[model samples]
Target: MFKINNLSVKFIILIILFASLIFGCTNNKINQIEDLRKNNNELNKTDTSSSPTKLTPKNTIIDLENTDSEERLLNNIFSSVAPSVVHINITKEMDVPSNQNIPDSFGFNFGIPDEPEQYFERGEGSGFVYDKEGHIVTNYHVVENAEVLEVSFIDGLTVKAKYIGGDPDSDLAVIKVLSDPSILYPVQLGNSDNTFIGQRAITIGNPFGQTWSLTAGVVSAVGRTMRSGNSAFSIPEMIQTDAAINPGNSGGPLLNSNGEVLGVNTMILSQSRSSSGVGFAVPVNIVKMVVPNIIANGTYIYPWLGVTLSNISLDIIDAMNLDLKQRGALIINVFDDSPAANSGLRDSQKNIEVSGGTITIGGDIVVSINETEVQTSDDVISYLVKYTQPKDTIVLKVLRDNTIIPIEVILDPRPGK
Candidate 1:
């Protein structure tokens, strides 16, 4: 300031302007804060009691005093069915691989055991009491080749079980435990045919070796077809659910909201070998049909036509010069000596390529079974399982050479039955 150059004078003026701007902004902020405080005071003084508005957000509101009825029902179901549910412990003999011959550094030979060593592989699954006679319903795979079976009840009572009968076609097995009648709570079997999609589905099982675990979901689908790993036949009228069924859940009861047994939890579709929410159960109707037969005999005899059937595809339709809307079960191959073969039912003789792949055509397309209209192979299988029995003569209305022809076939017991 004492020796004022032109630059020094400009710098002094800039400092004065910046100081004025800061003071002005400070004053304005103080006024705005005071106004906000006044508005808050006015709002607080207002009579909120007259309107009675909820201060909390609607989504965050909690009904602490009230209990959800569905939740209570779930709890009730678990309590009532826990006694009927059982933990099945399996002991299977596994062949341990023998080591190959190895030579030491000194060229000395070391020989492995001549016979492979065997060890017991322990596994567990779940089951439900089927009757007062101590018959426990479970999956056949659960007890397949099982050397020893031990069943544990909710009361911590463990008893040895003997496999009475098993049907691999239906994946159902009956194991009898000599337990007290008082401890055996047979689950009420529900009619799976009456089940509908979106109906509540519940499961009581031992998932991942954890016993008595309960899961809840809804029926994803009904009347589904699931291929059996134990047989060449497919299980029809299956119940599909989103229920979390894991490794140890096989053979457990898939229940309804009323605690009635709807199906037997059999398998799940997953990459991790655990529940990915796509689980399937053998319908109780199939259980009703198969279990009694298994108990009476060693196996359940399924009605077989011995024809490998395929759904009519677009390629097949085009190859056969059929309507685009044509739907039926196409006869792919008729096994020799089968009912279909003996009845003169024809198989596909021509091959045609489609967008997907090559397909066989010129086969007799099954349009109806026993006078019932069939749209696909599933209809035929379901009809066989539900209505026809082995040795029963049935008529199939088939589309052959653009003409419907009726063929009578006497059903035979499925192979390996």
Candidate 2:
């Protein structure tokens, strides 16, 4: 009986201990599950807060507003600049022989011709008000030989304008209208030297007689040269753009996004005599230089170098034994008693046949002028025409007999000044 009682007590003690252990383990697992649930909730909250919001109607509205702002900018530019634009019409008189043949019945016809008949030829172009003095700036070709000039504003106001002056070398001209200063809106000039390719370019002009037409594009290129119509000289440092400029658009202002004048629409490269997505403008910097001179003088005097120049090419290099890498303007013929001759510059001694044709030899090659590289004849011409004037002295780095020499020449007015 004693043994049985002891065993029963021991079994009871073991059951109590085992029950405590099982309950303790269940509580611990519950705590672990709770901690895991808390961590997962925090992670989900963070993900929800960090993810991008779905695009909604509000975002669409914002995009529309941005587009509207761009439209407003272009509209504002046009409104401010169109008033300064003008339509110019010119009439010229020409003499042509009369079509009437001498009647044989009148006399033994001394083959003398009949009196010439006078007729009026008309042309149209565009221009802009330049200043408060009612001065207008335009292309020289626009007002060339103009006997009568009629200037029309955007508001249907027309006035008779007189030719002030012009410079064909720059293809720029100025005219004056005797109008009230209150009616004239002068355009602001922008610094074209700061212009970059792909910047916004705007133009306002009369194209095909459509007055005050507006076009927009980006600057396609800078520092270009174009020859004036049938002229030996070329307009240099032109701004090329894809603006829709046509025949009558000549002389109109090319503006920047700020409505400031960046250039003057001059010409277009097209086979159909229309816009071919390639139009050129005389840079505003050149306009600034030439306009003031045109207003004071009747014509611009180009600085004369008095030498025919040829570009250094591979053929000339091989024929003259010149350095293959050297590029410059080759002096072909220095005129007598001219600035080049007075400066003791040497010209070509002879012409020799090369692979490319006849190449001139025995001439001093101009490598640099006034610290500017003279890589071609155009470079020398453009640099002198833009930066130097008559009586100005320029330093030329010349290459002679494989020796570099510096020559100083005092510029003179263009031949036949």
Candidate 3:
């Protein structure tokens, strides 16, 4: 109804065109947003099976493969050797003074004790099956004076055992059980002479009365000698290990990584009555030597050198005016009509006190026997026990009066054999 100018009409047409263009753009944007939301919903509803699924890389398999080999070896060794190990319990009868105070007729206080009372002392140790004939090998001290011997297996079965024979010099003893041969597992004896330091050493025994406990270590040394049992004799060719062996671990097998018996765990050097990382084992080679003789006879006959020898110490070197590096067994005394006496080996004329200690002087020093060097008294004993027999002739290298002389000696059976 209102009159309009040409310029005004043009302005109104411009505004309407601008509005239409803006509305069209806004509607296009809304449609695009709706399409985007629909696409998102379709993506959310899609099944995982419709496409290949992405998986995280698994590294556990590789980790397991890397660790399985060593673990398997240890497991297999333990499984194979544990069955041959046994627990030994011994009961000994001891006489102890009775605590009862014998009162006078008036019941007056008196400190006089009653007669000695008998009591039972019990000990525990370890052993291994030696053969299929039910022979169990253990330390002689374990069964020494044992009134009752009992052997227990890993399966909790126990039986009374009888002492077959024992050699106190080697601290080894054999006992027999009446078990069936099919149930026994004899240990495989290894060549202890071939053992080397740093090789894996494993021990299975009843440590602190815990049955069939396993410990692992490395062989610390070989060819060691230690005093065994109550005897003054020394067990030679001992294997030294850092394995944790305690009171009940004696006579158990010291096994190599291949599960072969290298030695018999005998004693530990410790002040705490526990394992202090220094444990000794009797070499299987020595065991092999003594066990055969024990089985053949009721006892093992030890080969003797018929001379009392002492290791050449610094005191001896100073007193005797010998070479500083001279290491050998010094002959203290030779038995009458013995091998050393008959072979012209001279004994020490006198004992002289030196700054270090008292040493025997003017003795024939045994440097070697049959080309084998004698570095210590133990070395001489070890060589004789391992190599020589009765009635065998051995050539001795004697160092006397600054001269090296070869003396031939014929060995004889040890006296009182």
**How does each model score on TM-score?**
0.82, 0.77, 0.78
Q: Which is the winner by TM-score between candidate 1 and candidate 3?
A: 1
Error of 1 at 132 (Å): 0.6
Which lDDT value does model 3 have at 417? Answer: 60
Q: Model 3 compared with the native: what TM-score?
A: 0.78
Sum up the clashes in candidate 3. 0
Candidate closer to the true structure by lDDT (higher is better), 1 or 2? 1
Local distance difference test, each candidate: 0.92, 0.89, 0.89
Candidates sorted on lDDT, descending: 1, 2, 3
Off by over 4 Å in 3: 1-68, 97-117, 415-417
- Kindly report which residue stretches of model 2 are placed more than 4 angstroms away from their true locations once superposed: 1-70, 97-116, 354-356
Q: What C-alpha lDDT, on a 0 to 100 scale, does residue 299 get in candidate 2? A: 70
* Clashes by residue pair, model 3: none
* lDDT string, candidate 3, 118-149, tens digits: 77999999999999999999999889889999
lDDT of 2 at 285: 90
Q: Pick the candidate with the highest lDDT.
A: 1
lDDT of 1 by residue, 1-417 (tens): 478999989999999999999999999999999999999998889575687765877458455446788877888899899999999999999887655568899998787756557879999999999999999999999999999999999888999999999988889999999978987889999999899999999999999888899999999999889887888788998999998999999999999998999999999999999999999999999999989888888778888899989998777777889989998999999999999999999999888777888888878999999899999899999999999998999999999999999999999988876
